[model samples]
Target: IGVGTCIMILSLLVEAYGGYLLTHPPFSVPYYYVLIVTEESLEMIGTSCVVGGILYAMRRVSKERLKFS
Candidate 1:
């Protein structure tokens, strides 16, 4: 959770300073960069993270239950 929180904070900071959607004269982002090619790519990345986390948590919970049983 701590790691995920850190990562989310960093992403927000990057988006805030780097660029924003529906803005004029594209903001000149510096210091760091992320190669996001398209909108769908970003959606895919988020969806993959959520699905993976859910699956991982389910597996962990089932394993712990098995041990108790």
Candidate 2:
């Protein structure tokens, strides 16, 4: 649970950074690639975390049920 929450927070941070990069391009290089990559990575991370959390919770519930029987 804690790890999932942490991942979500990190994803939010990445998204914010990506938005900033889009608005304010870097001096040396254009930030379009950086922004796109960051956005996609954040989305992937968020989705993975959500799916992983759901799987973990389901497994925990199944284990508890088996223990009762």
Candidate 3:
């Protein structure tokens, strides 16, 4: 969980950096590549989060038969 949180923070930072590069000057080749990769990473993060949420909901719903007393 801690590592996932760290990755989430880094992902947001990358997104912001990419946004800044897109709006500013000096749009070099390296920056363009960074922006592309970061964008892909952000998409993957979003997809994973949605999938995780769905799986969590399914797990909770399926656990109705469990008696943990």
Candidate 4:
């Protein structure tokens, strides 16, 4: 969960940088497009991690309850 949150924050920063670059780009147009792609990819990966973490926690809790029963 913490890892996912960090990634999400990082992606947000990347997106903000991209927005800033729109007016003051240091590189070519293609580079900005690439940055956009990277930002989107990061967001997807972060979401997956959060979901995976939730599933793992749920499984662990279920296993503990089963043992008690």
lDDT of 3 at 43: 61
Q: Give the higher-TM-score candidate: 2 or 3.
A: 2
Q: After superposition, how far is residue 69 of candidate 2 from its true place, in Å?
A: 5.4
RMSD values for the candidates in order, in angstroms, are 5.5, 3.0, 3.9, 1.8
Q: After superposition, which runs of candidate 4 have C-alpha atoms over 4 Å from their true positions?
A: 25-27
Order the numbered candidates by lDDT, best leading: 4, 3, 2, 1
Q: What is the lDDT of residue 35 in candidate 1?
A: 27
Compute each candidate's TM-score over C-alphas: 0.46, 0.57, 0.55, 0.87
Clashes of 1: 0
* Whole-model lDDT values for every prediction: 0.54, 0.71, 0.73, 0.91
Alpha carbon deviation, residue 59, candidate 1 (Å): 0.4
Task: Summarize candidate 2's per-residue lDDT along 1-69 as a digit string, tens digits.
Answer: 556567667767877876676677553245656656766776677778778889999999999889953
RMSD of 1: 5.5
Instruction: Point to the candidate with the largest lDDT.
Output: 4
lDDT for 8 in candidate 3 is 66
Candidate 1 global CA lDDT score: 0.54
Q: Which residues of candidate 1, in runs, are more than 4 Å off?
A: 1-37
Of candidate 3, the 10-residue stretch with the lowest lDDT total is 1-10
- True-structure lDDT of candidate 2: 0.71
The TM-score measured for candidate 4 stands at 0.87
Span of 10 residues, lowest total lDDT, candidate 1? 31-40
| Candidate structures ordered by TM-score, highest first | 4, 2, 3, 1
